[model samples]
Target: MASVALSGKVAVVTGSGGGIGRAVAIAMAEAGASVVINDVGASLHGEGASGSPANETKALIEATGGRAAINTDSVAEWDGAQKIVQCALDNFSRIDIVVNNAGILRDSIFHKMDPNDWRAVIDVHLHGTFNVSRAAAEHFRRQESGAYVHMTSGSGLAGMVGQANYSAAKLGITALSKVIALDMGRYNVRSNCIAPIAWSRMTSSIPEDSPEKKALVEKLKRMTPDKNAPLAVYLASDAARHVNAQIFGVRLHEIYLMGQSRMLRSVHRSEGWTPESIAEHAMPALQGSFMSVQSSSQLIPWDPI
Candidate 1:
């Protein structure tokens, strides 16, 4: 098979200063696509900002003889999102791909979590994806072709214990990507999501040095090693043009495609049942159905039949 290449294409990767975003940006550039690196240099909690990370990534791309530019735009605001896309347009003339990888974590059990924490995570993860993807989708519609990769999470797909806020935002991203895929299909724009598990500064806080931490880290490592950029790069390339409205879980050496949300399920109805008769009979089935329900795993596995 011939190798996939992205020559003459331009890609914008939000949160590209470090971690998966950085890796994806570098990989896309390596595959011959011009890249725009955007990051706010915020901490895991989404605080603070600096220009160093974006600049450093840009330098790395340049050193590798790849074209790139750095944009220190926060994905939280509409203007920032517009500016990030505009940077690509100003420099590269056209945008062929977008990786909406910007995110922040504000983990707290729902009752204990503050409104501010919930809003902050939602603004960054859900609204952030919307901002950037919306901007890029406009340009994509004009050009009649584009690719979008959203950074979702396992927490979002399968809720985590302490990540109520983050999980909600991440899941919302999956929903957004699906809607975009449906809306943009006519424009030849492909939209998908990735539930990635990798070790980065965001996840490094879970002590990997000790035995307890070591086990957890080891489990995570099995999902995706440090270098998990190849899949991301492929998704952002022309090779994945036909893949849309999908969610994938990318880890060390394993790729698990996900299925669609189970919005409805099989039901059995009894004949000639009054309200009381129906209540007694249907209650058990309803409860069983509800209790046995499993959330959709990742968004990447289902092939449209």
Candidate 2:
């Protein structure tokens, strides 16, 4: 697999200190891609920075006979993001893949959420994705080949309470992925998103104040970080060459091809009547197709199995 599929390729996985990012980095290394482990070593809420996590992942990859380099640049800044992609060239001489797995959560309910919290999450998730992907785009265009695997979330794809900022940023990632795929397809560069359902540091932050929530958390725990790594690896490799601009979800043993924004039902009026008539006629015609407001848990109410 290495010799034929991914040998001589380089991959940069941002926020790779631990959890999903770390898992993806290790998987990339194992699949024969020289990995750049980029992490700011921040907490779940984007507090503080250290180099320990990135170093540990680098060591783990090397100990298992995989080549990896540590990079501690935050993806939120264009300069920092540029350095991350450049790290691959410096260490491996070329880059073939970018895994936009870096993220920090600032989950808050809509009413009480502060502006700072919203901006922080958007900066890291949305802007960071753009910054890193844009930085890599230059090389990808010149070489005429590259693959991008971005970390989206159920919180974004599906509704979740107390996470308006997160949801918005996440859903926005899907749109960005779609556009990149469309714009870069001529260059053989592809972009795709993964809404991973894993019990990692990110999920550890979920409130567990009641038995029901606690039980849900337990089910979540079974969906370990590694469960999502294989899909990321496949997406980054040439194996998914024909797959582009698609949204996927990795949940335990289930891999879902999630839906994008598409019209379910459309109402057309010959005359385009007044507001009241339209509301009365068009709404009734469209009401059956209207989506219900449901959180991620409510929609997937069954057990993980």
Per-candidate Cα RMSD to the true structure, in Å, reads: 4.3, 1.4
* Candidate 2, pairs of clashing residues: none
Instruction: Estimate, for each residue in 234-284, the C-alpha lDDT of model 2 and write its tens digit.
Output: 988888899999999988999989988888998887887789987899889
Q: For residue 300, give model 1's deviation from the true position in Å.
A: 16
Q: Identify the runs in model 1 with alpha carbons over 4 angstroms from their true place.
A: 207-213, 221-226, 270-279, 286-305
Question: For model 1, how does the per-residue alpha-carbon lDDT over 51-169 read when each residue is reduced to its tens digit?
Answer: 89998889999998999988988899999999999999999998899999988887776789999999999999899999999989888999899999898988788776667888899
Please report the candidate that would top lDDT against the real structure.
2
- Candidate 1 local distance difference test against the native: 0.84
- TM for candidate 1 is 0.89
Candidate 2 segments exceeding 4 Å error: 1-4
Give candidate 1's error at residue 181 in angstroms: 0.6
